[model samples]
Target: MREATHDPATPLATGLSPAELRLLLSFAYTGAVAGPWPAVLEAAETSLRYQAWGLLTLCLDVFTRGLTPETGLDVLAFAVAYGLAQVGRVAEDYILATFPSVVATPAFLDLPAHLLIRLLRSDGLNVLHELEALEAASRWLMANGNGQEDLAKEVLSSVRFALMSGRELKKVPSVAAGVADPKVLRELMVESLAPMAQLPCRVRSLQEVLVVCGGDKLTANLAARKPSRHLWFAHRYLSAVGLVKRVEWRALGHFPDGPRFRHAVAVVGNILYVLGGKCYYGVRDTLASVYRYQPMDDSWERLASMTCGRSYFAAVALGDFIYALGGSSGEIYCTDTVECYDLTPAFPCPRRCQPLPMALCGHAACALDGTLYVSGGCDEACQCQASLLRYSPGEPAKLLAPMNGQRAGHIMEEAGGQLYVAGGLCQRDGQTGYRDQLAFEVYSPKLDIWVLLSPLPHAHVAGGAAVLGGELLVLGGYSHETYKDTHLIHAYQPGTRRWITRGTLPHAYTDFQACVLTVPPALQWVPPVVSGNPPPPGYMP
Candidate 1:
């Protein structure tokens, strides 16, 4: 034991050995010394062990500047022990970003069970798949013994089993065998397979949004020639900051054989029901065939055909029924026909409902509180009209207040007891050349009135629109000036009452359809850990 002058001002005069005292004094006075860093670090480590945390932190602040992957783990362990969350986060990120392979090292396996749990529970850990994280957690639990079973259960709970595919879940038993209780593990599996409405865990774990297909560049290029079979899903993810969202357009399964456009799409539970549309540019190419898509498995199955072939129609889901309204049938330019399909049965067929007061096509429709509302479309003469129709059960269609403008190919979505209509072709001043309209309007069912709101930033035609998370999202469509297709995604903020461009689609699409449904979160990749540097000053384990 060596000691120097006892001044309360200098806290370093405590129990340091001669070598540590000399090294520390030299570093404090001159900020430079000629000794092995390892020796100096050992003294700092001793200070940490003795609970001289202030002195240890001072030493680490000066020396931790040159930390490498090897030393990062030590510092991380120390920071974690001392509850220095920010410091631990930096060290963890550095290790994962630089020396990811360290996660597989024996040292990682030896991390205290509690520390392992903390790491696993961190949302920042971006593992390639939840299964990989599960495996690591399982390994740590097994090494620690069943005594940590409670902790192991808590650790495993953070794993997003619902996000895993059926194939991936099959491997859970093999990997989770000794780590989690059989009953607990079985509960997780059951939750994953449970219906979306009845899901007990992470009830809103997956954030689902509207997916638009076929309005892209591929569809435009093939429009004049032949239809394209390719289709894509526009997936949206909210970033950590919450201010900006990212959209990734992934390749969903394609349409069967012949591709179609101007189709009507509606979502009933998890299934997407697609109605009639034109398969080709030819007048005779109008299709009556219907199909349904299951996003979970990316499978499409043909459904019973509609009563009549049509294109540019509107479809809406009201409870267990889907209502398909007016559109053009090949020979007939426009029709007032309305049909409803009951999806409660295994194999369903469409039945004709009371026709509209007047024949119309290229219209927009939505169902709210058991009433069907249709607005702004081309009439029997194929001319744009400002007509609005309301149909209730056991009653004939009733004409409501007309829209401000004559709109065709517009989109309608209902939210918070109001109907929002945006983007379409409008005929003003009796002009033959139809103009693309940017005007946005909302209708209140209770008041039977239409109110003008902020117009779209970009005037689009035949775009797919839906209400998601209380915000209005308008997907890919085309503009008149360019006469070109656009993949632009525009979202309207209710708070601001303004439309902001969220992001562009992978490809521009027009006349495509979109619907929102809840699905699993996509998988991501996480980095690894490593070793080499000594533990930070005062680090316990």
Candidate 2:
């Protein structure tokens, strides 16, 4: 196979062939037309290797004043059929600019339903909610395109997209009731909006804090742009502890023009940072951009570029430092490259921290006392890691603790002056007899020993762990198989030394960072208002 040339004659390198060129017509120019009625866009409707629908819609304005009512309707018709977006404001401006009485016609109704349906599947509600005319068009399809499978698909897609809106839709209440069933919403949002497949995977760095205060708070920018994804993971941890008033939906692509940050996440005071994960550079290649989310401003700021461009790496923050631990650049491989940024105000520079002793990706980390602890990561050999290393802020990390057996993809919690490692592959040697490899163990920092705790009522690894009400609450993660498994959340009580299963997470919110946030006792109460609700909100207050 040959690569597509650096030639305008060919836009794609492979996949679609030359014979497909029949889908399009020669480009026509009608911008100068001052005749009776709407003019047609000149860009070809179709071309080999792709659809030129976007460029054509752009021409709708460049050529027609969009004042040409019939021409505007035609472009909208094509856009609705192929699910084209981002052209509405310009196109509408043209429609009013042309200053004609625009009306919907039979051709508009006859357009393929797939585009309208696909539009519904757009991310957040930005595209979908913006499509007032298109949504109305889809409703027409549902009522008129009823018996046809194509029409039914548009109806279903719109319904699915509307439910995904995460905001209440007055028009679709009954449909929302059926689809918004806590059981269903979480399943729809796990995958990203990017038309890509599992670009390897990595969880964000989240600290488990105990907040006795009540109400649910969104984790700053964890899913800042896509609250739907945040809501799916938010419920289990946020509502469990009562730290937010609600999972607000202000997080829809707030950084629409910001640099791309894929497969990455970071947590600072009230800010969430997302770095290079996977952004489409070519059809298959991923982007390497970084973004920062500020919770207070509800905005994302672009940050320093990564020294080494990579995605799918685990990130952890200890003290004023944030670290991108390990992950791959592209291939299904593992890396131990570490890049960290010191947020110290006087003079901050990002440099490589000590690399992991082994290449551990898809791992979890927790900070305790003064040391950064990491555990339960899988390696290149596809082996679970039982090795635990503690990184001192200024000094080198020492391998003070080794788990009882091979463990990976499990949760780690540091509480009450002890390190609790549970729900990983705690392999047993012949010394302990059991056909199964599922169990948990706790490391005593004081006694310098590993003690076996109660086994999970059901086996789980790579789950989420947070210390809430003095118990370790473990949420959604994969079992031995299936990354999409969501069933029960196991709560382990350290005092009673037992495991009690709680409600299942909405879905498998596996392997992502889960934090238990709390306002410190000192920061808990705000000073009352000196002059009717003029309260000072802060630790100083």
Candidate 3:
């Protein structure tokens, strides 16, 4: 028998071996641990079992950073056993994102049935076709379904058979009949033949959700417009009879304060940061207040305010900080001040950064390859700008080749490793007057050139843009030509080089911001209901 510590101050290690106790003590005092793979895992297990939270957290960090295709399934099992929700979520996401490749690994066959079902049930599962999901389920059953008939039925049922084509459906019985009850399989096959419009199963799952926040809409009675504090996100889409499709949008609660528009929004990790914007219609109502929405709790927290009030500005998250660039500061004209918030701090305050060379507003900005790129906005003189500028902290802005034409209130986003600028008011060449720009453009960083693409079917100004599932989406914005807000959503497909209508917002919303988020399960499972209920007459987006 080994002797125990006699000192009262020395904490006793009840469940840990001598090696694990040493590893834990070292991590406790130095915030780091090291050992062979087996010993490290043992330390992690002891840390969690003994409630050494700090050491456990460090272990999780190491595990997450070290995850690979071979070790990902093991991480999921460990996370589930230790109640490490965040780690489990990340591992599951990795597995789904690389499903095709991950499925080939031997570790995948060893995945427990409970975990397999959880992955299949997620809306975030990434698959090019329903057959892929069916294949995965079949493989799992062949490996693990030996005597677990009920479990086999549940796993097979998780695959969305309705989304599979007739040929794909035919293979289901051949693959699943050996494991699941033949009677149950027959009913599923019958159900899949019904018209897709009538079927309840969603056609596909989305890993990234598009969240539209804080835009203005015409109030009831049509007397005046009111800003909306409501936050909405599309969770699923249902297709009806030919050419008719509807989106399932649900509320993710509301923003803090009253309501805001002409503001800026950015997402770092899963946290949403809502920055300065006017709360009301007053020209001078610009806000410096900052708030963040935590999806973990569906809660909002007010962070340190910006140094200057701004609206019609651009915000982008880079590294550990969110940069708030040029916009109007409730002044007679826009301002060129720029600031950033260090997300590392609990109560992060804005830190001053090098200002833009000229005052600009209604512009669009995106961070690409660690550098900031700003394009197409109005200068202080109220003149639309065609210039593109590259900027970095503490350094003067560098001007690049200007766009083919001037624009403002447009959207700029990075997709497929390049930047795309579209939809804003643009000056017609040689004309003193300006019109809504239907023709969009793309910028190539390697060649440093801007090339015009096909024109949009309709124009959008002050619209929100986000990249979801590798597609560039332009959300609700009022048309400069018609001077009316639109609820329609347009997505640009790079493969076809065409713009396709994805769906519409619940309301005609403009001057808002949209970001792609991997919503927490709490918010994702909120029972999606079709919103767009006939707005009491005269409801403008």
Candidate 4:
């Protein structure tokens, strides 16, 4: 290979150490094609106090490889001071990706104000429980404020105190003690006392994840026992690096009432509205009872019942109302009737609305742009239908363009201003009759069109599905051959146009409902509290 000459006229060339100068010459010779340039740049800055623009450009090429964990913080400080925002952001991403390791390091509290603010504003910071973020913010302010109350207030403003638990908010002054301005502290206290709706810092949509509800399962002692059933809530958190972890299935206290399956769940604000479903296995007995679950307080309360019992229905929250569309009622396999529940405190009962033109069951529904879209369900005849339906508040449902394939027990969700349907049961060749479906399709309301995208890795039906972090997560369903529950969890990445297995559910489950819930700001992972004695001070739960 031909040797390349370094441009001595390059900025700060004279200040470069021998190692840095060699790397710089290589960068110049190869037109900045190199590996591990961040290491080279770090050495250059540490020894020679020089930042070669060429070397920085090379570093960008290997950004995806990530920075060494030990060097990430130092590089971030250097990047910020040099006004290399793009580089700083990459460094910050690395640091945040390994947040659990860095969170306890003293360097976390010593980060410059600008870098701290940038990390706090990131949606990826959801990896840190809100309380941890709060503590880090307080420590940083206390360390860097230097008795400047105004600067302390400015730094504190970036912390989402409204999302913290009421108990944590009460200790804010003690946590921030000598650094926080009394006036600002008083304002925070007053704000914490206000109703949750009025709080300025609520959980953002990206921080939310799908919570899977009750399902059926076979017990370990299978010889003489019937299949076991459960009424619990399953939740998981995705790391900043897109790895799903900490899958938990927690019981909603004891199910003194009964077990439910094939139900419908809708979230309006912080409350979960769980609607009707069958009470037992192989029993025609259905329910009209409704319950509201508040995760913040870990409490459940009974709500007004629907006009009639329903199961395998499509429910969606649009505006301030919850709409229950066509589904089976009692012995009837299907019903065309629709009902709307006014969520306003004055009228909590579900009232009859204009019925669907035809009955539907095992369908999916989602709200978008003040309209409700229903897709892929079996008709009253029990035949899979590809028909798509749209409904407005006072308007009767209208049929839109049919889907590319008939689907029932599929998943439908609205994302990026489009509607996506994936995995279901569809009629196959005459020899095969009906079979599980792997087909996927997208609909654009603006264009009035349907486009088939990549298919799922395998056929799935009755899976819990939701959009999290701008990707589609399909969890725990079954196929035709097995006829048993599946623990698989698959994620569809639009950028890659492929399906990747993210992680498995804690248990195999089917016939369950899933919806995203914004975690309470003050929620922590804490051990069980014993009676009488108070929890240890500052202990996270």
Choose the strongest candidate by TM-score: 3
What is candidate 4's lDDT per residue for 1-541, written digit by digit as tens? 2224555446453555555666666766776544454565554354334556555555554543445545567778877777767877777766665554455566666677777777776655633245566677777776687787776766666666655555556667777777787788778656554555242444322345556776555455533312223444333332222444334444443233577777888889878888888777554678888888777776778878988889888899999999999888888888888898888875388889888888889988999899999998988888899999998868767889999999998999987678999988988766556788888999999888999998888667887888764467787778876676677778776544667676666577777766677654344333222235465333322
Query: What does candidate 2's lDDT look like per residue over 440-526, in tens digits?
Result: 778876666777877777656545566654467676555563333443567666545667654554334443444443222332232
Best by lDDT: 3
Which order, best to worst by TM-score? 3, 4, 1, 2
- Per-residue lDDT for 455-492 in model 3, tens only? 77767888889877545788888877677888888877
RMSD of 1: 21.7
- Give RMSD to native, each candidate: 21.7, 26.7, 11.2, 15.1
User: Candidate 1 regions off by >4 Å?
Assistant: 1-206, 216-231, 236-246, 521-541
Off by over 4 Å in 4: 1-117, 120-207, 221-256, 520-523, 526-541
Give the alpha-carbon lDDT of every model.
0.70, 0.48, 0.79, 0.70
TM-score of each: 0.58, 0.45, 0.66, 0.60
RMSD of 4: 15.1
TM-score of 2: 0.45
Worst 10 residues of 4 by lDDT: 222-231
Candidate 1's TM-score: 0.58
In candidate 1 the C-alpha lDDT for residue 518 amounts to 54
